[model samples]
Target: MQKNLLFYEKVNKRFILFLALVCFSGVLFAQNKTITGKVVTNESDSSLEGVTVKVKGSATSTMTGKDGSFSISAPANATLVISSVGFLSQEVAVKNQSNIIVKLATDQQSLQQVVVVGYGTVKRKDVTGAISSVTAAQIAKVPVTTLDQALQGRAAGVQVINNDAS
Candidate 1:
């Protein structure tokens, strides 16, 4: 009957309108750009790995690679928030730049403070290699390429002799 045909036509028209609206909404939401950047230490300029890079006001986020590089998709004007343990968080506006460099300073307070909120038990007999532990502060005092070289004379009973003494 014509009534059934009219109802089917109305449904078809509504389906086409719904599809067009969905597509228009997608365009209005805007396309994001691929942004890339490197995060480094402000003082030493060394690249930092495992730093979290996130777009402000959005859940999009990524972590830097071993080379301290990151790629993320975000709106051109979005701001990037970079953070890492023991380092101060920083925010940089994208400003339509495809590539950017972010420098983060060491948060002295973060390094100095400890949570002091953990409890664990370890039997001495169950533990091994308790000779000595090396702290990062001590290692930083020495200037050497290899950690073994840096640790030379730093820890008791720890000796590192280069086999190739050329």
Candidate 2:
């Protein structure tokens, strides 16, 4: 009878030890992972500087370096959201991957944020008078042989006809 009681106590002690080990292992494995990536433009394949890289559903975020490289710490199942001015945003899944490459396309919508009227700049909403704006980026898209040609079709109600003054 005494032997039976001793056996029962030993079994209970082993079970409790096993439960404690399982709990400790769970706590150890629940840790964050370090993720690294690079950001570039899809059109030009150039490094994008000062890009904002954020962990989705969390406040953890970091900015890219001058070489478009970034490093952050997050959970394995977390998602990363990358964004910058003049470029479209991108979201990538960690999925236990350590290194990633992200390409961002240019966003035309950001170009409409400001308007150049005459010699000064103004926000898009504050303009109440007739204003014609031309952005340097828009001019770069077209092949203009002269200054007159660059302004062609850029502003509303404005016409640029080459008079052959040369």
Candidate 3:
């Protein structure tokens, strides 16, 4: 009877150890894989720079280098989303593949809608600031000493205050 109890104890210990190994093996094998890819223009096949690459369902992301090459870690079956300015975004499946190449078509609407402003450029549809023009006639009508005073009423939201008490 004692021998049977000892055998059962050994069996229980071995069973627990086996279960632990199985759980750990599944986790180790399910880890994220490294994926590499390149982004290029559909028309020219020129490598694009500063393209954004991201894992579809997670925050993992990277940017393409000057050569349009990128590397990121994601699940083996995960999807990758690529995006850039003036180009349509794309998605690729990472299923048992380690390398990929994505061609992005130019968005004519986006290209035509960009407005070059004072310092930078932005989409025309996204411009929300009021652009009030001060005409030369308006500036001539204002008998002011400086240009700031001339824009007092001709321009919208213009405020000129003289800080001199004299």
- In order, the Cα lDDT scores of the candidates are 0.85, 0.88, 0.86
* 59-165 per-residue lDDT for model 2 (tens digits): 99999999999999999899999997667889999899999899999887764688766569886656667766677898988987887789987888887777686
For model 1, residues 1-166, the per-residue Cα lDDT tens digits are 9999999999999999999999899888876999998999999999999999999999999999999999999998899999987788999999999999999998887455433211554433334333355679989988888876987887687677767776
Ranking by lDDT: 2, 3, 1
Off by over 4 Å in 3: 1-23, 26-29, 114-116, 119-166
> Which pairs clash (backbone N, Cα, C closer than 3 Å) in model 1?
none
Query: Which pairs clash inside model 3?
Result: none
Quick one: ranking by TM-score, best first?
3, 2, 1
TM-score of each: 0.54, 0.56, 0.60
lDDT of 2 at 108: 71
Q: Give lDDT tens digits, candidate 3, residues 48-161.
A: 999999999899999999999999999988999999877899999989789999999988886666565666987754666654556678799878898767767775676767
Name the TM-score of candidate 1.
0.54
- Model 3 compared with the native: what TM-score? 0.60
